[model samples]
Target: MTEDSSQAEHVAGTEHASVADRAAGGKAARAQTPLNSHRGWSPAEDRPDPVALLEEQNLTRVPDLVPVRHGRMMASPFTFYRGGAKIMATDLKDTPRAGLIVQLCGDAHLSNFGVFASPERNLLFDLNDFDETLPGPFEYDVLRMTASFTIAARNNGFSSSDIREVTLEAVRSYREAMIQFSGMRTLDIWYARMSEQELLAAMDMARANQKGKAARKASKALEKNALKNAAKARSRDSMQALAKLAEFVDGHYRIISQPPIVIPVRELAETFGLTAEETEAAVRDQLKAYRQTLQDDRRRLLERFDVVDVAHKVVGVGSVGNRAFIVLLQGRDEQDPLFLQVKEATASVLEDHLPKSIFEQPGERVVQGQRMMQAASDIFLGWTRGMQADRYLYWRQLRDMKGSVVVEAMVPMGMTFYAHACGWTLARAHARSGDPIAIAAYLGGSDKFDRAVTDFAHRYADQNDADYQAFLDAVRTGRLVARGGV
Candidate 1:
């Protein structure tokens, strides 16, 4: 595909150009990069002080939020504060040497990895969530991932030494793996994946105490159907959501409507300068985009469901402020329904660092990126442009079987297995989109680079903790309002 193949499929665009040639061919396309997209912010002043930018953007305090999973504790504002990619190094300003950085899942924490069914009916596990996903220095993903381990360990009340050890373990794994990726035959890295049994055995061998037990338990569970059967998977996905929708109090999902759901912010039409008719039409318009994004089967599937109700539901820690909504459409039969999540795709943080990104549309990057990184992706994954809005990307079904390992729960032994899985998944993802041979070759036959990065990770993790605290201080001291997901 030519560097211009955003217009075509993922085939090598215009024959495989060297990195330099590809960069030059991609120059005109850089407009898609978020760093260059928004011109209003004063770069000279703001870019220098990410700390100040955090305050200025009012990114410090967060609001109350719920976990997408059932039975997990409600994530605190502190959790969001830590989860926010805003804190991830604005750019890879300073770091150790890694030959090249690919398009990274910028905020790739352990929790962000999961298994999802692809449109082709493959159930592949990789980076499952991409809200903060953007193309930037690969180290940014590393730093963020390592820091998350630190924070998670802290939350779990692990000792400083334990945190340090786990942090080192995770970073060491990535660094070593990347070096391995650097030297691989290209095909090897592309085909890499961690078998559950292999991983469980590794965890047992590492035997970090309780972590090992957890890994053993997870192993038993995964073995039943690590790859879910379609009938059961689809039925399970459909049933739980349909059950919840019945109790929705005007766009709010309630198992039985025990508490009033957060009414769509738009219910107060005054704020949006619209009347009831206009608001109704706006919801319909959102659904229209949803309708256009479906597959032939999905379209046919939706034929059973008419638009019953629509409401903008806020989602995620980093994405809390963006325009996100849920369209509740029901089939002719009361039990049949579909939930489509319409999330506003804004400029990505990786835009600046990703060449050829300039000319691409931001919303398109989201869909395109998700497809590239995820081995298996949601069938509903599709994008649409809107007249009233800049452009809105629609992909439905975020919460089905979307369970994940709580990073904080990783026991010592499980930490080892967890690190291996994350490394294997991340390596596979890079191999999918990049030249993994050079990456694997770079580290050929040694864990030296991994050890170095692990050291760097510990030091950088300290910086992240400091940064996280600074944010909390900014909010508490009234520098930022600390909006949504409190």
Candidate 2:
């Protein structure tokens, strides 16, 4: 057997072990890799060049849009970190591990967690992005999450003490929540989710604890802002997307052209030396294949719609340059619209240092990993191979009441509250796929893991700053090209 596979098998062997045995194994792991061992970061002398790693990713992405990705990453250290998952994955491979494995949100930074519509149409908060999801050591997600909080807080001009407190609270919440999940029934853990009502209640409790007039006023403002954001999210469905992207053309709705960022399929057909009809036929065939991946009811529902227009669109800081297309479909009439986004799925960044995914198709790996980790995933989530060789893609609703917190505008209290929420949510996700009993036992009732990870987060943020400077230097010297303010 391959060494990577063997290591994975060794770590995963306790899956069916008794509770007592699992807990014992966790304690044994503590002896071998102490909780405090996760306390620091020092890049190895032979660490790969961060800029080089990014450029390597650019090799697979659209050439013209690659500069946009570079520009996004050049905005700040936090943006760079968001786009530097591959670089971090390389560095994390050499870090201490307890051998406890779980389905990782390989890029589990703060912005990746958000509120979205559940299949039930209720608003729920959970991990929203799974582009880099994979199975690996649980600490990988935890450390990446904590470091994101640190970097975001620094960007917001938070005090060092406040930043540390926010980061520490996030890990503490995860550790404590995992311990709680350890005692719950398997089905109960599966059913657990953070609904909008629960979130509002938590906010109310925080507001009640405020001391003085100014603090109370600020807390109330934060609560008000959250409600406004939720209301905005509710308005961000396919209709909203249609209004923004489609226009009446030749007696039918068609996607409007916005050069570079959003170009209609006709424009792309010419660029690729194909007739417009041929391009549409190929897209329709691909959509048919993607439809087969959906459930019977969803597939029937999709059958009610007809493709109106398709456009290539740029999306996300890290996902820019990747092939992402938005398809506008009309249900009964022009007003009834559904927007589906087809995004290219490359191999997980974690694959280099961990065992390759069991699923052969990269798109299926993302779809399956997302289904395993999320309490409620997008109903339209599915995968298909693109017409081009070596291309795999996944499809989902372009927008379904999706919203994220403005980390840049957050105050200390708001950020700490967010940290706690993300921590608990992440633990619940991990518990669904990992042995919570063993992980909780390893963490114990102490804050050792929390403190150690928080320390590591600060150090990692420093490393990120150094890497950001290197990237900026590369751009300035024309080693890399960047188009900012996109």
Candidate 3:
């Protein structure tokens, strides 16, 4: 075995007991890794260059859109941190860890958690992104999440004391929630979820604890804002997508071109030097293959919709350069439509340091990981390979009541409450994939892990800030090109 592989195995053996050992519960788990020792942060004397690591990731992404990725990462330190998951993965290799393994949301920053409609049409909050999901030390997700809160708070002009409090509260919530999950039955833990009513109730509780008039007013405003955002998300269904992205062209509905973000089917075909006949044929074959990945019922549901147009669209801060295509389909009439996003799935950032997944296709890794971690998933979720069989891709509804908390406009109370929600959501996700009994035991009923995580988050945010400056320097010196207005 390689040196890193051997070390990982050793760490795993020494830090966490096997499933049989885990039956001994918290006491046995604590004997393996103490909670207090998790405190402190120390950077390794030798570390990889952040810029080099980022440039390496760029190699796998689309060449033309790479500049746009750079530009988005350059927007702010927090934004840079979003795309710098690879850098942290490298740094985390040398950090102190308990070695308790779980299916990690490798990039489990604050914004990655959100509210989305479950198959039952109930809006539930959970870890919504799994592109970088992998099995690794559980604390890695906690570190990523806490640091994100700090980085975002700093961006929003939060005081140092406030940042620390928010981070602490987030960590505490996770610890307490894990304890709650530890005592529950397996089915209970699996069924546990945070719903819209529960979320608003949390906000109301926060609002009640306010001391000053201004604080109370801000709390009320945040609650009102959240309600408005939820309503807006509910309206962002396939019909809305059709209205915004499709137009009645030559008596048939076709995607509207809004270059360089959204490019229509004909435009993309010409750009690829393919005739309309070739492009349509290629799409049909890919769609047929994708249908096979879904369940029989969902496949039949997809058959009812006739694909009218396809477009290449830019999406997300970190996923800017990745190949993400939106397929527009009509059911019976132009008014009834469904939008499916067929996104290219690359090797996860965590794959380098973690065990390789058994699945042959990267899309399978993402789709399976998501289904395992989510409380409920999309009925149409599935995967397929590219025409050349060189690429993996997954398909899902474009946006069915998907929304995230707006961090930019948040007050201190709002931020703290949101942080708690994210922590609870993450803990529930971890409990589904990891041994909650042992994890809760390892954490214990103390603030040691909480304080340690807070410390690590602060230090990592400092490192991330410095790295963001270096990235800006690279762009300024033409070492990296960052396209403006992308």
For this target, which candidate reaches the highest TM-score against the unseen true structure?
Answer: 2
Judging by lDDT, tell me the better candidate of 1 and 3: 3
Error of 3 at 146 (Å): 0.8
Q: List the residue pairs that clash in candidate 3.
A: none
lDDT of each: 0.54, 0.91, 0.84
In terms of lDDT, model 3 sits at 0.84
**lDDT of model 3 at residue 350?**
78
Off by over 4 Å in 1: 1-51, 55-81, 96-101, 119-123, 175-236, 248-261, 264-268, 290-304, 352-359, 386-388, 482-486
Per-residue alpha-carbon lDDT of model 3 for 262-380, expressed as tens digits? 98778878766679999999999989999999999999999999889899999988888888899998899888899999888888887777777657798888898888778888888
Question: Which runs in model 3 stand beyond 4 Å of their true positions?
Answer: 1-29, 270-273
Please, what is the TM-score per model? 0.73, 0.97, 0.94
Between candidates 1 and 3, name the one with more favorable TM-score: 3
- In the range 204-284, model 1's lDDT, one tens digit per residue, is 554443456666576554433332432344444555766754474665442232212335434646656788778878767
Error of 1 at 355 (Å): 4.3
Which one wins on lDDT? 2
